[model samples]
Target: MRLTWIHPEDLIGHELRQARQDGRAVEAIARRWHDAGGHDAPPMAGASPEPAPERLRRLAEDLLDELATIPSPLADREPTGLDAVISACPDWPGAPLAAPGPDLAGRLRGAWAGRAAGCVLGKPVEKIPREGIRAIAEATGNWPIRGWFTARGLPDDVAERWPWNRRSAPTSLAENIDGTPEDDDLNFPMLALALLERYGTGFGTDDVAQMWLDELPAGRIFTAERVALRNLLVGLASPETAVYRNPFREWIGALIRADVYGWVNPGDPARAAVLAHRDAALSHTANGVYGAMFAAALAAMSLTANGPEEVLAGALRVVPPESRLAVAVREAADLARAEGDFERVLDALHARHADLHWVHSVNNAAAVAAALVHGAGDFSASVTSVVSAGWDTDSDGATVGSVAGGLLGADGIPDQWTAPLHNRVASTLTGFNGATFDTLAARTHALVQETSG
Candidate 1:
């Protein structure tokens, strides 16, 4: 068999562009290409290409399969208590608040504070309908979906109050929905705390990613082949087919949350990206990895500068130029600079790219783009812009917020954002109840010390 290598760029040119420009159906193009020779098939002869939806879906499914194989073995024993969890760390000095080396302490503090703010940011809108989000945005003059929590109308100490569950009260629109607000892995801050608690200071991105997969409950999850198929479909095609397509909204949060891994490494965004890749592979691929890389690179950069443009530039350096993610980010940057209204920019991007996937790569990439451009390096502004623009709001907001928080440090985050959450949050993961930001940070710090030492 004569082997022919199909570069990602070739796929983009032959498949992606065809779907975008030639008006060919993704499935027909894909089927023709598959029949002609699989990826090596000659470009369809005079085939009018369909839109990129099916191609996007195929890509998503392949990416998911790639993600499912990254192995993560659990610790020899499950943690019995907080002390048991803390005891896992031998390197942590367990230093008092007045201890030396405030930089480490500061990183720890910022991680916790960021976690709290993340919870507050995500709590009110966990299950909010699109109409509700729009209404809130219209009523408050802030983009409701993204900027709802940032409005000055909320209480001063909202986040700080223990048990943020009360804050989950149905947003006028959700009032009729039954049942209390539930927290799951989809909630970024809570997930962060869970990882911190389980791994302690040993929490590297690889470990975190594995933990996420392990949470799928061994027997109930999809097979590796099924995961691969699902990834390939969703990544390369449209995510509109919710039944079988990848749940990108859920995955992007996981992908972006790996930034703290990069942040701990310092000036090693590549290492961060690598770590993120390992984790992301468990559930995503291609642009999924790009999403993780973007978040990790931004977090790594945040350790050095507070400029959104600079940080985005740094992130772009890490992702391949041939990727849709790169293209989307570039487009977003252009829109952010040229357009005055952030919503308009998103609307424009959607008009062009929405068919690709509403919650997958292109749209999420747009969110990252909006955050960096409109956020201008302000933690609140970046998060607000990313979230408010809608479409995978939490994932984009979390990534933007985390990177901004990492850059600004704990003290740099506004009091209003941090003060409301009171440095506390919880997750659905079984082992990490009653976690505080300070404790999670201390555990993460200790893990790094142990790993690096």
Candidate 2:
């Protein structure tokens, strides 16, 4: 049986695509793989196929090492070091003092609840494309997706055509949700909270790696994280762990882990971004690292900004302007403002980013940016729009929710959205399963105070 992400043959296929994206000279490597009868990686999540022969696996390892040494043509524009990243951004805003609003507790509660709510909302349709989501929702009379997705009234034809994500359907559907169900989107934040509690605000990448080994189950990780863990188990350190044979180094994994960093820093986008970058470097690079910084900075700005536009503007300052992630985010936000209709904006975004993998940081971050800008501070609207964009649905939804939640505060989010969460979250990480959002928020609030003091 094939292990989903760690197999060298599968990994090499994805690495080739990543190499091509970053402008590496990989024509010879591609030819070698094709000549040896190797296949490209499948696009869907958690795909497992029969393993390639030992000879091919060995060849794949050699090819991956060669690909790594060839620097991307865009390397100068998209530096991975924190100092280099900040240097590339002309508008780098230094850290802000903690300036939380009067209802800091309430906003924290809202942020956590909103994350759980949005994550659960998107869970059932995690891998479904936008067209499939629309078809399934329309058939069930929930076209705009204002609430939890239900399999209850979904027509049999539509169900077969766009099946619910198998793991999520059992616990995430409207009829089945008891509380926040387990998702990597939620688990990563829990880990962040733990990291802060254990090591304070000065935690390093090594602390993050140790936190994962101590709390995060091996089976629970996926994509870049899974590969990073594999490297860690073999005695490799971070930065190296992130790069070695990890084709998913630029995917959405690190972005999903960023919210709590922002939560701890509150109004300080630069500080939050720095914290996020340290954690992100454990499993990602360049665009992937920038995606984490963007999300953290976005979450930080949400705590004190007046609107989505202000929040976005502040968040964009942390990312290097010329990086692909930054470019996509700017383009997406521009399209969102120009086009009043969300469907039209999505059409343009999908067309523009057609080359990017669905779960790649650039495309999904674009979706998150567009959703927030277009949602215009409405909690339901922002979460739904991002989820509907259909790439890394739960991850985007959770991020949009965190920002909107902080911006609106708990009272501002509609009862229809928050009530279903039942004030609780579930996770595979130690001590977080069945934890209440209120408790998590309280702990996060304490961290803010600790950091500020």
Candidate 3:
């Protein structure tokens, strides 16, 4: 069944109507277009805007009719399973990469710690507008943002317009920082770990859907996952749960959950990407799905990659080369390499992504690519640039941090980044909350070994 009634003021609904005629959602393809510097729909020809209620009614009617018709050829694929995804992967450019020598456990530890640190760095400012983060950072002497933000002594007028994540500020700020707090960015990875342990590499999309039903809290899920959960609750099946009323299917949710797939696969990028696809397909499709695969592949290769550049290249090979997500990632990589200043690269990213939703995976993938490429193997440079670049700051920071940390190894990660956390990470998952990175890393290393064996 259709969502039937979307919020009247929802801009996604507005874009959905225009997109539906072509059988597209407001994300993925659209987000990719924006991330590569495309503009939004030109303003209505006339200055006077149409009435909201009438517009909503017309849009709703148009959407229902559009859904009844055959989707456009350009529209994203339906549920075709892993064979479709395997065929989609761009052929490996060179021999499959080998895993890093020595310190496997250390690298694993670093990834978990770095992900936590970078996520915490951006947490307080997660959804704050890019300019707002800039303004607040500049005010607090943190612009070009080398560290976590603090609320101490900022002008109210500036702070008023650019508020921190109110729910996050107490722990995310510099002074109060203790441990990595609960965030879906980390939570999904935890859930993924559970999924892997229970089903090994054979787990399918249906397994992931059932796991979510058993473990993840409804309130904790958002956007696509939330929509998919509602769909599952109401009787939608495996891939159907992803599409039914889930316009958010292409948002950053899947991307945020991909690290575990990579962590368990190490140097096996193809395997990692496929596992990510199985997991991502439960709630996302197209580039949204590709975002997870790309990230997981990056993580898998980071275990052995000589540098972020090599990791980035391996990642591109795991997704359809022609996909908009790949296009956006390629653009971000190119722009990042050419642009010298970290903030300037971000300025370019923000400008190009201005037309898309802040949380869309295409734009977020661009942000992640910029962080990895420009970061060029430095942990601080990597996390700082991604977080500073804005547009879902926490997720970008967390992902970049994970890649960089994996590449750098635990011993290589600076104390300044990890010490603040006291070597701890948190999640609400049973027996997982407030766990030490050391323990998680050890478990992850054992699992990766078992899977490879």
Candidate 4:
């Protein structure tokens, strides 16, 4: 009975760590866990299956409850509510007045295809570190990630040392890819699309919760979304589902679901952020919510942006200027612009955010921004650069692909990247399995017209 992500004992250890990062004083709580013979939580990426004794489990549950109520010192500056978030950003860009252009369909098509291509590219190495990724890729002659990873000539030692992510390798490799395989990175955007179609852009948080129960498979969701699913099943409501016993509230789950919001609200970052806020509020808080807003804003701007620098600057306007996530993006973008080499920029970012979990919103968002800034509007360069940085590779690649794709349009992305997808994608959602990206783009474009009108 040791479910890896949700076991109360395991969750308490992670919650303690999360609280401390939020500037909450948790020294006494850490001492209590140590006194109780509990080890610190395993790294967020590792699996631990040994069941805790009953006493420890109860203590863990009680501690999680206590942790939820403790206020972080940064709370006021990092408010989660949409209005408060907008208020915190003094230079906030009001909603863009520009409408989607005649080429909207092509841009949307590029975004969908680009997202799938980039996601597929990073899948095989999702959890491997930067050095390991480099080692494996260099060994296979794919270093700098010019294309999908391969085992064709990888050394046995390199293969053993940096094994491909088990679930991703069989389907995501260059030789094995048929159509895009089902991945949470792509699934969430599909879910967002379904949500808009069902409830329109004005859908509430409850609507988001209900949609998951109806369409999103419980097993497919993870981390914060998993906790929120559990909360919803037990009858806990919207905003509460995001916080109760949910230490993963600030992780990157919300960020990945942001693209459809931006897609439908093309050229309007402020409105895109508001829609993203509604969706993100169901499972995330603080910087987690901000991460979604940032991505949605970026994606929205990409439809009309002249280049990556414009996309980054316009997106930054939606995030709270003083929030840690904002500071990280600004620093990452600044360093990328100044240094001009992605590897050096990544090293600086990795060292600066070493204390963060691999899936945390702040670090992953920083990496995405750095990639876009460094890539400077080249579709191949942007997606490849982000995946190479190694934190949440698939997710970062998908977001970077999305923004860059929207900017470049379908005709601009290289055929090498788009051809493998066969214009198709797979999903666990009811109507999306084997759906073509162009069809999805048409459907999404229809919404853009509807919403804009």
- For candidate 2, the TM-score is 0.98
lDDT of 2 by residue, 1-453 (tens): 557789888888799989999998899999999899988887785444677889998999999999999988899999999889989999887658448878888888888888888888888998899999999888888888777788888889999999999999998888888878888889999899999999999999999999988988878889999999999999999789999999999999999999999988888889999999999999999999999999999988888888889899989999999999999999999999999999999999899988778889999999999999999999989999999899889899999999999898889989888776788887878899889988999999999999888
- Model 3 root-mean-square deviation: 6.0
TM-score list, all predictions: 0.61, 0.98, 0.87, 0.98
Candidates in order have lDDT scores of: 0.51, 0.90, 0.78, 0.90
Model 4 residue 449 distance off true place after TM-score fit, in angstroms: 0.8
Model 3 lDDT tens row, 350-426:
78766566778889999999889888899998898888777888898899999999999988888888888987777
Q: How far is candidate 4 from the true structure (C-alpha RMSD, Å)?
A: 1.1
Q: Indicate the residue-level lDDT of 139 in model 1.
A: 49
Which residue runs does candidate 4 get wrong by more than 4 Å? 44-47
Tens-place lDDT digits, model 1, residues 159-239: 233112243534211222221122332244345545655765445545644554555333222222123333443453222
Q: Could you give me the TM-score of model 4 versus the true structure?
A: 0.98
Instruction: Find the 10 residues in a row with the least total lDDT in model 4.
Output: 40-49
Please give the RMSD to the true structure for each candidate, in Å: 13.7, 1.1, 6.0, 1.1
Clashes of each: 52, 0, 0, 0
